[model samples]
Target: MKELVEVLAKALVDHPEEVRVNEVVKDRSIVYELSVAPEDMGKIIGKQGRIAKALRTVVNSAAAKEKKRVTIEIL
Candidate 1:
């Protein structure tokens, strides 16, 4: 999960090396916190948060295959 977020974020950011993903696991859900260079934040988020929503949708779909609940937070 972390790797997925990292790869996706790196692909969207200008400073790919600065992309970071942190995972927090709970009993029923997983939280992925993503971070990127300040300059690349907007690129990852996209206009009006469309990109972020799409990313979250993809993550959720993947998690669904494993019967797991996952959430993505960009910070």
Candidate 2:
């Protein structure tokens, strides 16, 4: 999951080297905090946050089979 978000964010950002993903495990779920270069924020979020929403949806569905909760936070 961490790698997945890292790859996705790196692909969208101008400063791929600045992209970072922090994973936090809590009880039965996982949370991913993704931070990218300030200049690349808009690209990651996209128009009307469509890209962010899609990213979340993809992560959610992928984690469903494992019966675990997953969330993506862009900062």
Candidate 3:
């Protein structure tokens, strides 16, 4: 899950090397915290947060395959 966020974030950001994803797993859900260079935040988020929404949707779909719930937080 962390890898997924990292890969997507890297691809979206100007400073790919600065992309970082941290994951926390609980009993029923997983939380992925994504961080990128300040300058690239807008790019990752996109207009009206559409890109972020899409990214979350992708993560949710992937997690559903395993019967898990996951949330993505861009910080």
Candidate 4:
């Protein structure tokens, strides 16, 4: 799960090397915190948060099979 977020971030940001993903496991749910270069924030989040919404959707669906809730936070 961490890897997936990392890959997605790297692809979206110009500073690929600065992309970072931290995972926090809480009970049956997984939380992912993604940090990218400040200048690349707009690209990752997109206009009106459309990209952010899509990202969360993808992660949630992927974790559905495991019956776990997934949350993504961009920082």
Candidate 5:
């Protein structure tokens, strides 16, 4: 799950080396915190958060196969 977020963020950001993902596991859900270069934040989020929404959708779909609830936080 961590790798998935990292790969997605790295692909979207100019500063791929600066992309980072932190994972927090809970009994019922998992949280992924995605951090990118400050200048690349807009690319990850897109206009009106469309890209962010898509990213979350992809992650959630993958998590659904594992029967886990997942959340993505862009920072």
Candidate 6:
């Protein structure tokens, strides 16, 4: 799951080396925090957050098979 977010974010950013994904497991859910270069924030977010929404949707769908709630936060 972490790898998925990393790959997506890295592909969208100019500074691939600066892309990072942190996973935090709570009692009932998993949180993925995606961090990218400040200058590349817009690319990750996209127009009116469309890109971010799509990214989260993809992650959530992939995690559905595991029966766990997953969330992605872009930082």
What candidate 5 gets wrong by more than 4 Å, as runs, is none
lDDT of 2 by residue, 50-71 (tens): 9999988888987887788999
TM-score of each: 0.95, 0.91, 0.94, 0.93, 0.96, 0.96
lDDT of each: 0.90, 0.89, 0.90, 0.89, 0.93, 0.92
Among these predictions, the greatest lDDT belongs to: 5
lDDT of 1: 0.90
Q: lDDT tens string, model 1, 1-75?
A: 778878888888789999888899988899999989999989999999999999999999888898999999898
Q: On TM-score, who's better, 2 or 5?
A: 5
Model 3 C-alpha lDDT per residue in residues 1-75, reported as the tens digit of each score: 778888888888889999988888888899998989999999989999999999999989998998889999888
Number of backbone clashes in candidate 6: 0
Taking every candidate in turn, the Cα RMSD to the unseen true structure, in Å, is: 0.8, 1.0, 0.8, 0.9, 0.7, 0.6
Report the error of model 3 at residue 1, Å.
1.8
Residue 36 in model 2: shift from native, Å?
0.4
74 in model 2: Cα distance from truth in Å? 0.9
**Model 6 lDDT-worst window of ten:** 4-13
Question: In candidate 4, how many Å is residue 22 off?
Answer: 0.3
Clashing pairs in 6: none
Root mean square deviation (Cα) for candidate 3: 0.8
lDDT of 6 by residue, 2-67 (tens): 998899888888999999899999999999988898999999999999999999999999999888
Per model, state how many residue pairs clash.
Answer: 0, 0, 0, 0, 0, 0
